[model samples]
Target: MASLELKIEAKAKQLGLGPIGIIKPQAMEGYIHRLFERMLRVPNGEKLHRGFLELFDVRQAYPWAKSIVVTYADNSIYYLPNVARKHFGKFFLTDNRYNINAPARKMIASLTAFMEGLGIRTSWNEHPGVTGLRWAAQEAGLGIIRRNNFFFSRRAGSYVSLTGWVTDTDMELRSTHKEEPCPEDCSLCIEACPTGSLSAPFTMNMATCISCANSYTDSTAIDDHKLNVLTGSWLYGCDNCQDACPFNQITGYSTEIDFPGLMELDHYLYPEIIADLDYEDINDFIRPKFFYIKSESLWRWRLNAINVLINTGSSDCTRILKKLLKDPFEIVRRRAQNALELLGS
Candidate 1:
């Protein structure tokens, strides 16, 4: 029988995978310690426990999937339906969601099921940190961290999700020391934050971000001005800074993991769908991965989107806004009502 390393590599290549590699478990300790040090400096280190434990096989689901590896450059391209036609010719929304549509859900389920079959368990938690995943992938010999503080695999650029697994079998790799810190001159991701959320290099101030705020459910006493600026996102999420990265721009198309496409409805198709969403509809569809939005975040996002529309002088959505005044999601409805007041003022 072929070795586990060969098996995974063969499977990936057979599927036309972009780039993949392996990392030994023992090699992960240093980066793990550094991340812990950063966590200690941050306000609440305890909150990161779930994320920390997830790096190891908290549940040894698919032991053969143990080696941390990833496919890169998943969402560098997107089609802006409203302005894309006028500015970015021939650009279309990424159809990534299509592949994983039922398949994505099924694939995740299957992976989990396979883990269970192998006596591994999976647990859901609140917002998990990306650092642990990053560390594990690094230890697994998958890739290195670039100046942008995002994973920099030769193939995927920085667009890959850092997923992990555990297997009974140990994968072989040419042991090497962890990569050194990023180059000093590379400040692309920091320069890309429109809201200045990156307080220091590699540190994200989550409270002020559009993505984080957009996921919030509470609309209490939020700045109406800021909220209006958010609604510009048509679909589920935002990627302003990532889009501006030099590495991201040059990344070839990702062929490995195929779920989160450029314009996946959950991520980029903002204005139209959100304009029509009610509480129940949101709960059913948007709340799953977008739980943050169902909270105060969606309210802020709606308000921000409205502001973006008004500022752009895009009157096409006037009717939508008028209807949004009666939305079931109180935050969205309230904010839309307020945005109307601002427009009239």
Candidate 2:
């Protein structure tokens, strides 16, 4: 069994997935339950469940589940936007094209097949799954949850995506290595947060997060201050916190796997191009990769773009804002009107 586990670990590393470890499902129950309870207490905490602990009743999903194989793929934040802009001439947020979720899913599928070939039954989960990835990864000793509320591995910083597989096979469990990856004196990420989302050390107020505000499907749900915070050139997700982390400066891009979709940047929409977009353009070009924004939430993108223009304070944006004043979506029209007011045009 030890030899087989070694083989599996080597195979995973060969497949460009690693910092792998194993843990018993029972070990995670208490931590997950506590985390779930806390999540329910926060505003918009209901939405956090899918990524945190909603579907992840390990005993229920994997009745025979004995161990979870937690694995992470190197997703250095440097390569993501840099490669997209170099190839596609535009910056990309953490969408399908640049985010590690897509590659993590691919790794899970491949790992499942590999385990099945060795006569082991395996089930895997990604974002909205029966496994809470961050907790599981931390339990498996792959990383530590830092003060910024992101998983930070010694080798990968916070620039990796997590995935896991559950199986009936009783593998040797990795010892839990509880770590405080953050330096005691450094609070750069907390200070850099524009919306005061990082309320304290290792705490996050998700409702106030600029990234959450940018991704909100309903533009009306966000107030003016949140809107202003998001207006600072962010169209989808905010990287201010990550950018401030000193540990993230270490290079992990060398080990990053060149996944297929990383180069597919046609879906990335820029601020200068938003005023010219119609429903057809969005449906045909942007909808496929940026699916998280949703078809009904198309106005959010327009609002983000308008906010970007407003933040730039470019007089040239007046023409674009005027065009968007007649936009079919009420949210776009209203945001555009407000943007014009800010522009004093």
Best by lDDT: 2
At residue 251, candidate 1 shows an lDDT of 68
- lDDT score, residue 14, model 1? 47
lDDT of each: 0.49, 0.67
lDDT string, candidate 1, 1-345, tens digits: 876556555554544443445554455567656666546645554463335544544334333443343332234332234443221111123322223542323333444454355453433221242225566655545676654456655455566544444444445543343445555776767776656665456565444555545444434325535533543442333465556566566664433433343344433345445455664555555444343454534454455456556656666667778887776567667767776786783
The TM-score leader among the candidates is 2
Q: Where is model 2 poorest over a 10-residue stretch in terms of lDDT? A: 86-95
> What tens-digit string does per-residue lDDT give for candidate 2 at 178-239?
54568788899989987777756666666666666666664444556555644477666676
Alpha-carbon runs more than 4 Å astray in model 1 = 40-131, 174-182, 216-235, 252-273, 277-304, 316-319
RMSD of 2: 4.0
Model 1 Cα shift for residue 203 (angstroms): 1.5
TM-score to true structure, per model = 0.67, 0.84
- Model 1 compared with the native: what TM-score? 0.67
